[model samples]
Target: MSGDDAQQHIYKTHGLLLNPIMCGVCGWQFYTLGIYNAHQWMQYGERPHAFRCHAQYL
Candidate 1:
């Protein structure tokens, strides 16, 4: 994971939406579904089933 890769991954992870996504567990809001998913992947990646939510339009 180079710096660029990390940044790109983060950007992709956070899709930059005008309306952010809310965490089902923590109730924290993120810029996009990708951000929430990335958070889950980083925070709960080791756990089975973890957590997830899809973008309503995407």
Candidate 2:
């Protein structure tokens, strides 16, 4: 498989365990979706949401 496909597969496979309100890099968990999204926005500036949880790229 292509690198992109492999990465997508891994993300999909671990998506659930890595809760939407949790940080994949730091294990930080937020209380609500609002809070989580807010944090993501603050860190990632409203784009490339897929990287928010581990948004060092931003």
Candidate 3:
């Protein structure tokens, strides 16, 4: 496959968070439902939503 085509295919099922240290193209971090921290992850003292960075689509 061409480079752009392959990249587009991958983007459809994957996403990368803004963590530059965690490589987005390879070895990116993925978050699950239970990995949240109540103290650190709170938005205005409440978690607005479960933020997941599913590096590998599934």
Q: For candidate 1, lDDT tens digit of each residue in 1-58? A: 7654554566567646545567676788887545576766666553223223332322
Q: Would you give me the overall lDDT of model 1?
A: 0.56
**Model 2 accuracy (lDDT, Cα):** 0.54
Task: Give the best candidate by lDDT.
Answer: 1
In terms of TM-score, the best-performing candidate is: 1
TM-score of each: 0.39, 0.37, 0.25
Candidate 3 or 1, higher TM-score: 1
Q: Write the per-residue lDDT of candidate 2 for residues 1-58, one digit (tens) a residue.
A: 9655554465567543223357665567864444565676667567434433655333
What tens-digit string does per-residue lDDT give for candidate 3 at 1-58? 8654454445445542222222223443433222322322332344434334423221
Score candidate 3 by lDDT: 0.36
Q: lDDT of each prediction vs. the true structure?
A: 0.56, 0.54, 0.36
Candidate 1 backbone collisions, by pair: 13-34, 13-35
